[model samples]
Target: MNATLVAVVLSLFSAVAYAAAAVAQERLASRTSDSGVVRLLGSGAWWWSVTLNGSAALLHVAALKYGPLTLVQPLGALTLVAAVPLGARVAGRRVSAVEWRGTALTLAGLAALLVTASGPAPDDVLSVPEALAVAGITAAVIGALSRPGTRPGLRHATASGLASGVASALTQTVTVAATDRSGPLLSAQVIGVALLVAAFAAGGLLLAQTAYRGGLGAPLAVVTLANPVAAAIIGLALLGEGLRGGAAGLLLALAGATVAARGVVTLSRPVPEPAQLPTKEPEEHPIAAELSEEEHPVAAVLALNPQSASYEPVLIPRQPAPAHLTPL
Candidate 1:
């Protein structure tokens, strides 16, 4: 098949794999309350996420091999459109109607973006130090942003999204470095390329986990959307990929950004109070649980925190609250 066709298929498949991995990660994040840094590396789900992302990265390289940079780079964006609904479905997280509208807008913007650009750009390569510098800076930001203890906020979300994007960009960069046409695949320096890829991927994963910890959707959208977008910008700047068209392209760019941004903004809105529910996990200590069982067994699941310090009450003979609580 032609390179564009290959790229199209690869992009779609990448979208699927990425979407599924994200669903798994979001679910894992929700279930645990550990530091995002620890969970970033410790979770088995993260490994799966990295693997899926690697596959996507490999496919992306193959696409660039035969296709135009314009075609291949924009197609990478399909992953953003793919991640959310898949996440919600897997996690039983429902999307609001506003979110649905936002998703549609993002997809529309991407579709427009892909169609507007034309022709492939020539291959380019970054020196070892250049790649390392880029990846290193990205890693620091991602690591800082994904701290689990941090409250979810615009800063964290934006940073996490940027880190995620950097991860995506570095993956593309590695793809380029690994498969540059004039050089041998492992010409005594491929190790550097491989290491960079791993480093960037790990950082991205950490950032994403943290992003989820702070907030969902918005951070998710930014990272997924921005990563490849940044890479494409780099490609245009460093590798000489043309912006394709003049005033029209500029207008399209603004409009598209607005649409995608709205979609992200809409998707990020928290669910309304009408759908709120209470949890008793914090209140489920041993005595409370024991008394709860005798009283309301139905509320146990609702009130129990899996890691709560309290234990289910056990009947012991006569233990009194020392003299302090007696009749003083």
Candidate 2:
């Protein structure tokens, strides 16, 4: 088979594997409230998800070896495309119309973003200072996002993407260094950067697993879009890479990002609950009812701020009883 054909096939398989892994992770997240690494390691489904993820990573690496970054990276966006429907099926439901539209928009935007962002690999490895700077910034961002009162699934997903993207950048540096003919294998710089890559990659995985707790489609799409965008920024800033097509490409990239962001927002929004049945009117003072199970928005907000002590039940002022009312 031609090298390009092999790469295309491998990329497709990689995307599928990633989608399947995402589905498994989402189910596992839903099944358990605990986010501890030790608890997740004990779950069979989590292990299965890990296996699928590892397989996808191997396939992605193989695809890169045989194909251009522009082609392979754009194809990686297919994971979101594949994941939406697959997740729906696993949940025993059809894909919602909004989900379909969001998935389509996300896929389209990411394809454009990846195509424009990809360029030749950097010639030089990241220096220790540069690597440390990148790591520090990523860690800080993640810490802020993980703090109480942030959005639950979405913030975690964004953090996951940041970590994964940084890891990709660091991995690129290590790969380039190791492959250089003049450079000795296992050089100090390469070793240091490789350790950073491992740390970031593992952190990304845990964050991704956490992100799946809410739902599948939106979180996955965010991660998919954020990963490449973050990596491309690092490439542009630190690695001497340039966007394709100059000014026009930058405009297109921005447009694509807007579209993708809109899509993610749509996906993240919970489906509206059906109208509630009218209840009998209460006499005099009535205690405000607690949030119902169907109040998804309130529940989501509470989930984001689990430890907040400020919430209080609303109380209605007492009113005089009607003169015509009969005593029960």
Candidate 3:
């Protein structure tokens, strides 16, 4: 297979893996009472989710090795596409029309962005000091986001998505550096990048689980939107990548991104009320009414004899036969 084709396949597989992991994490979140890290660590479902995520990261790295960030990163949006149906299946709910529309819009926007993206540039290796600085800044941001009072909603999920994006960008950088080098993989640069990858990946997983607690749409959307943008920014700034059509291409990409973001927001909106079913008035049964009246006749008897302590036989005196009967 062509290297580009291989990368595309791997990227798609990675997206599916990510989608499965998101579904698993959401399931685990819904069932667990304790949201603590320790509790999550102990959960089997959580472990399964972790395993899926690990596979996804590995596949993504493989894809990055052969493909440009512009191609591979935008394709990752398919995770959101895959997740909607999977999540709906797991929850036993049908995907609403609005959700379907949102999904279409999101897909369309991503397609537009992908088409307008620039081709890959030559890889640039980061120096040890630059790598360390990046790692430090990423760690600090993640730490601040993980602090208490962040609340478990859009804010928290967005933070998590941002962390995940940083992880992805770093992963690409590290993969390129490690693969391009002819020497041993344990070089200082490679090792530093590896450690940052581990730290960021782990942090992203935890935050993603946290985000799942706030439902799949918003956090997933935020992550979906942030990840590629972050990768593209890093690629453009650090690497020598450039858009195809210069200013026009950049504007088109931006517009597409905006549309995609709007779709995500729409997808994340609260579910609309289900279609109302017509209600039928209960049919009255005459026999049932009679049975009810027979079952509670004490009230009627009490009304007739209010003075009586309880229901008993009441006798009336009978008069003697009429007088004036002739003797036989």
Give one digit per residue, the lDDT tens place, for model 1 in 176-243.
Answer: 65677677767545577566666655555655665566556666666655666666665666556654
Q: Tell me the deviation in Å of residue 196 in model 1.
A: 1.5
Q: What are the per-residue Cα lDDT tens digits for candidate 3 across 287-324?
A: 33454433522322112456765664332223344567
Report the CA-based lDDT of candidate 2 relative to the real structure: 0.75
Residue pairs in collision within model 2: none
Model 2 ranges off by over 4 Å: 1-12, 62-76, 148-151, 267-328
Clashes of each: 12, 0, 0
State the TM-score for model 3.
0.81
* C-alpha lDDT (0 to 100) for residue 308 of candidate 2: 69
Error of 2 at 208 (Å): 1.9
Residue ranges of candidate 1 with Cα displaced over 4 Å? 36-50, 66-77, 91-96, 136-160, 167-170, 273-328
Q: Which ten residues in a row have the lowest lDDT in candidate 2?
A: 295-304
Write the residue-wise lDDT of candidate 2 on 85-153 in tens digits.
786687677778887887778777766766565554346557889999999999999899877666568
**After superposing candidate 3, which stretches have Cα over 4 Å from the reference?**
1-3, 276-328
